[model samples]
Each structure stands twice: as C-alpha cells, then as structure tokens.
Target: MRRSVLVAVMAIVSTVAAGCSSDPTDPAPTTSAASASPSGKPTDISFLVYGAPAEVKAYRSMVKQYDVDHPGVKVHLVEVSSADAALRRLRKGEVPDVFLMSRRDLGEIVDAGINQPIDELLDSRGVDFTDLYKRDSIRAFSHSDRLECMPYGISPMVMYYNTNLVDFSEMAEAGLDVPKNHATWTFDQFAEAARFGARRGAKGVYVDPSLSGLAPFVYSGGGSLFDDDRDPKRLDLASDGSLEALTTSLELLRKGAITPTPRELRSTSALDLFKAGKLAMMAGFRTLTPELRRTPGLSFDVMPMPALPDDRTLGDASGLCISAKAVNTSAAADFVVHAIGKDAVSDVAAAGYMVPANTEVAESDAFLQQDRMPAHAYVFNRSVKDIVTLPLIESWPALERAVHGDVYQLFYSRVIDIEALTKKIDEESKAVLSPPKASVTPSPSASASGKN
Candidate 1:
C-alpha cells in the first residue's frame, strides 16, 4: 500500500496509501534499531514528509515562522522518501519528536502506543483542534473517542485532463458542456467523453480505482463508508449506493475510460500511462492540492471530480501528527496550528501545494478563479462534505489494502456479479471495521500536552 513515486507512477492515486518513507529521527534499522538521543541540549524536533519538495519547502518556511516567533524551539525537517518508513521509525522508537505525517495511518501509530497526545497543549495555545476540520475527520485519531490526531491540510478531488489532449470540439459535437470546475456532469456524460477519447486514439481516462482518486466516485454516488453509529465497526462496502459506485468505476474501465487495461494494470503502472497524457479524465484526487500539482511536468488543471448520478463532491484531508513521544510538544503543536492558520494558508494555496485548509485561505482573492488555473480553487467549497470519508477502522492497514485490492480484483475478474461482490464486501467489511464493545482502554500515559 506504500511505495515511492519512482517505484509506482500511480502514486497520485496511490496517495490513499503512498506507503512508508524514511524517518529522520533514526537511521535505517539493520537487524535492530535504537531511539533518538534524549540527551540533546537544543531540544531537537523531527518532522517527516511523504510529500514533494514544494510541500517540504512550505513546511520548512512555516516552521521558520514558528522559530522566528517563538525563538526558543528548534525544529528539524526530515525528508522521508516515503510515509511508511517514517511509521517504521516511529514503531522502532526512532521517529521525530513530532511526526507531521499525513493520513489515518498516523492514528494507527498512536494506537500502537508510540506517540503522545497533545490536547492540553492545544487548549493552552488557543487553537481549536476540533474546528480545524469536520467533526468526523477528528475521529481518525480518537482513542476511546478522545482526539487522536488533528487535520493539518485538506484538499478536494477534481477532474484533471491534459487540455491539449481533450477534444472539446468533439464534446460540442455531442452537445456536452466540456465540464469545468463548477460544472459537473452525469456518469453517462463522463463515459461518453471517455469513449470519445478512446475512439480518437486516446485512452479516455486513467482513473485506476485503487488510487486516492477513487474517493469522489463513492461519495457522488451517495455511498456510506462505515456504519459507526454503534460500538462495532461495520463496513457498508456493498450498499446499494456503494455497489453503484463500484459498478460505475468498473463500467468506465470496460468502456475504455479508466485504464491499466486488465493487462497493463497487471504490468505497467497507471501513473505512467497518465503522465503520457494517454489518460483522458484522471478525475483528480488528492493531487488537487497545490503542493502536488506543482510537481515538475504535471501540466494539468483542477476540475471537480465528475458528478455522480447525483451532484456531489469528495474531499480528503491528512496532516502532520504530534507523536505521543514528542519532546518539543510546544514547538510541534505551534507549527501545525500555524500551518493551518490564516497566516500561511494563502501562500500554501497560491503556491498550489494543496488546497489551503484555512477557511479564509480557500476563499481568498488569490485563490479566486484565475486565468492560468481557472478550475484551481472551487474544489473545497463543493466537495468538502462529500469526501468518501476515510474509513476509521484501525486495521485500515489491512482493510484498505485487502478490501480495496479485492474490489479492484473483482472489477477485472468480472466473475462475481456486482451483487455478490457487494455482499462479500459487506460481510468482510462488517468483520474488519467492527470496533470494541466496551469502553476504550485508558491511554498508556495520560500526560497530554496539547493547547486548544
């Protein structure tokens, strides 16, 4: 589920599970490893990133801001080649004082007891951890429903195409509106355009469902992820809406829209095909964020992920985590809060690293529709509510890898009926997402240092 962009070009979609990266806190473990020196005088803090240089730069700049303002805390930025590597370092007790990691997997690290909590620190800092993102998102890090992690940066999904490659003329011939940032379309129209691309010596789209780009498909189709209104974690993998979402994705593949031709998927990578502009509608996923779009030759635009049978948008958020082992809890917490604050939001958004997570940043005049990047900013406004909300089940490691992998298999196998596939997914999901029945166990050490 995690690997470098060099290993898999589909890393854009792979953002859902871009996998492990190196942690600056410790060296690569040979047979075994040791923890960071607790004896350092400067109070060194380590931050890991599974993101591009631009993001690293943005993160560094923000940290510098904290340094300038606080003047006492020292922060270290460790460029981890992947996210998983950082997690490994954390488990081995060699991770940075603060992870600054992205995704729910960070929450998994907290569950494993390697990280510390920062609620008290946040409260003292006047930062509203809960308000940074939607309520449900906060649950990603909850231990016994207490805060686990806070959202750092978030972006909405959209449709991205190499405009030079799409034949808008042909779209006019078919009376299609050539969808824009605000203008969405039905799956039928999307399929038609994809088939049109294929007929004209193109691959239509490169939307491998196994990637992060698959989020909106589930949401726009009106799918519910996990049934969490109870004590058990039940997955609704095969609900009518979910099944429709899955089937539509599969149908697009069959119609020559989403690719990796059953064979290419087995061999070549979706990112390779997409980078070649052979893909028509990538239906941009997490990459809609600025840090990602600025990657060297991405030469793409941010269009809202196509609408489903109903019009809905999908948004996703992942961010830096303050390790339970965090020593400079004050410094780490301050940096994360500022990163999502109004001060840095506009710059991050304008830089196109990711959609700014700040309410003000997303609506800033700088982000308003522009000539160079017309479809760039509207994503968050429309899709925030519709994100194929990330699954909260702790086995996300196993569930995301297993269930998602199998769903893709079913798409290619075409052996099981959609209904059967849905049923199997439902049964397996219920088992996988089920939560504990009793009150959550108390945290190992209740010494939280977060500020609100």
Candidate 2:
C-alpha cells in the first residue's frame, strides 16, 4: 500500500528542482555505450509531453515534422497536464516510448526502476554528444554516469532591473554607474546603488529566499553552500564567502536598501512588485522573459548575475527521457534525437521559449534575436562559460526543503542570528540527507524523488 501510494504521488507532480553551483573538483563525464538494447522498429508507440499551450503546440509541430520525415514510423503524442499525469499513465501500463521532462526528474524515474539509459541508443543511431552546448546539463540526467535523457533547454538565472524605477539618469546624477558590463559589478556596488534608488523613491533590490535567488550572491562572492551535492554531510555555507554573501544581504535589508522586508519574503511577491514598478531590481531565470515582455509600461533588461569578477548562476535543463519499458526503443531514440536536433531546437528558440542546449543553435541568431525588449538578451549567452548544474542527488528534495525552511526564517525575522540559522540548516539538512535515517514525514518515497 505504501509503495502504491508513493507511485501515485510521483505520477501527480514533477517538482521544480534547484540547480548546482560551480565546482572545480568534479570529475568529467565519460561517454560510453549503454548496455540496454533498443527494441526493433515498430509502427506505433506512445509519446508524452507536458508544457503550457505554446510549448505544447511547439512540440506537437516537432512531432508532426518527425512523422513527415519518417515514412513507416507512427509516433502518437499525448499532451498531459503534468509529468505526474504522464507517469501515472506509465505506471498504469500506458508506457510511452519517449517522454519530455526536466533533467531533475531523472532520479525519481531511475529510483522507480523505469527508464533506460540512452548511451547505447545514441551510439547505435549516431547521435553525437559533442553537439550539445551544455555538457553539464547532459550530466545532470545521468545515473551512475550513464545518459538517460536528451537535454533541450538551458535556463540560467539572471538579474532583471526595471529601468522605470532604476532611473539611470538619476543614478548618473547621483554619481552612480549602471552595470554596463556585469563582470565588474560587486556586492558593494549593488548595495550602494540599491540604497541610492531607495532614497530616490524606488524600492531597492529584492531577492526571494529560495536557493535559486540566494545562490547567486553566494556564488558571485566565490562561496558555495555545498561542496559535493552527492555528499549529504558537505556544507560550506559558514565559509567566508557564504558569510560575506549573507552579511551583505542582511546589511542591505537593515539599511532599507531591499524589500520583502522581514515580512515580505514571499517568492511571487518579488515578481509582482517588479512588474508593478515598485522594485528596481529582481532576479530570475530565462523562463521569466516571455511573461515579462507581456507587461505594460515596463522597461527592463537582462544581465548575468552581477559579480566581483567571473560570476556564476544556477543552471537547469529540461528535455526528453526514454523509458526502459518502451517497446520501440529504436523509434523512441530516433524521436528523442530529432526532438533536440538542430531544426527542432531552432524552432523552440525562435518561439522565445528557452535557450537551446545545442551548441550551434544556442549561438544562432534565432535565440539571440527572439526578443529585443530585454535589450541585453544577447548577454544571456555571454556567461555561458560560467553555467553550473545542480548535482543529481536523490536526497536533493529533502535537503532543499530543510535549507529553504531556514532561509525563509532568516528572511522573515523569525531568525536573527545568520550564523546560528545557517548552522541549524546544516544540521537539519544532514539529518534529512543521511542514509539509514530515522523516520521522516516524506521518507524519500516516490514523491520525495518527485520535485515536491
């Protein structure tokens, strides 16, 4: 009964996974053929996908195109409301030959003993791994260092500043400089400008306490919250870099240079205030671009997370995953390859959906010219060299919750001592992450592997 309930919950929600920070000590990924064999050619197979209307439409078009190119193969596309819905179908014996999902979801799928690695499939079909731009993204979906997903979207967290509230002219008059090049912007500069903006009748910078929003500050300062994502015991949030990041944020809050004041630390509120022109600066990923362009009377631009020198930000990718239970693995792998191929990636980018994971496609003008509203859309790729992927840890969801609980406490005035709070986070996170652990509510069950 417990296993059945866990599987049902896993079928209902595909949680949004947090990303990893920069790591130099990590080993490189090895490309080897998987042991699983692709099923022989078949005329029919299920293909499941989930997304908003436009994204769904975009994928349907791609599938149609693939059908047109393949004479004998017929791929049936199922549009589900969520990854959970599709997985529920899969569990009920409606297994899909190919499915679209976040790379983060790979762990749960692996844990359930469902999907097969695509290494051998790629080799058999001659899919070149080098064609993908973000190798880190590909690695994110791997289990025991074997590929299980074909990456499509590379979403990097970036800073969006409202020009209306920012008043660059006012900043210039106040002898403050706008960040023309993100590489040189420091935490001191960010805080100073926020204070200036606050005095000028604009709310200063506001960051939601989520790991994605908070990690950039830690990363820009050259600190890491976790050393090895795979190691439940590893923590560096108390390190000098982490301390500096936290201290700067607290100081800014105390000085009235930021918002979500201990009382307003709500995630959605940051975007709401940003759109209402109440905020001068906010942070988010490329996913926010389309919706941001739809807002009226807002002049905004995108920039890499401002840093002391070579800055970094959280990176995540979503793409195609094939099931081990797939009856036609050959056709499934073919569709997977086609879905992330040059033509398909170009179409996805042209729609301004996301940054393609293909090297040539990402560098193409299709994505770069997709919008002019964020005059600095080009800068989205400028920091490609600094993209960091989150580790593929089964314990991530539990650790994320434990860490975020403390973050909200600190942001909301419930926690005054930053050091003490972070230490508590480290403790709670270890308890959640430790193997052979005591009983916990979530219990690292099917949904525990699911996003949330």
Model 1 per-residue lDDT tens digits across residues 1-452? 11101112122112321222222112121221112235544445677665566666766786677556644456677776555666667667777766655554654565577656544444444554333444334443344423445555565566666555565666777787565424566677677666666644557776645524454576677775555432325566577887788677667765534455676656656555556656656655545445324445656554556677766554556655677667656656666555556666665555554654445556666455355444445654556555544543354556656567556665566565778766766566554565335677656464353323
Q: Against the hidden reference, what TM-scores do the models get?
A: 0.72, 0.79
**Residue by residue across 180-276, what tens digits does model 2's lDDT show?**
5644465666766676656455577776666666777777777776755554354567777787776776666544445656545444477887787
Error of 2 at 440 (Å): 17
Model 1 residue 242 CA deviation in Å: 2.9
Scored by Cα lDDT, where does model 2 land? Answer: 0.65
TM-score computed on alpha carbons, candidate 1: 0.72
Clashing pairs in 2: 11-84, 15-451, 20-390, 34-120
Any runs in candidate 1 off by more than 4 Å, and if so which? 1-44, 114-120, 128-146, 167-170, 177-183, 211-215, 227-234, 257-260, 265-268, 286-299, 311-315, 345-351, 365-371, 414-416, 427-452
- The 0-to-1 C-alpha lDDT of every candidate, in the order given, reads 0.55, 0.65
Q: For this target, which candidate reaches the highest lDDT against the unseen true structure?
A: 2
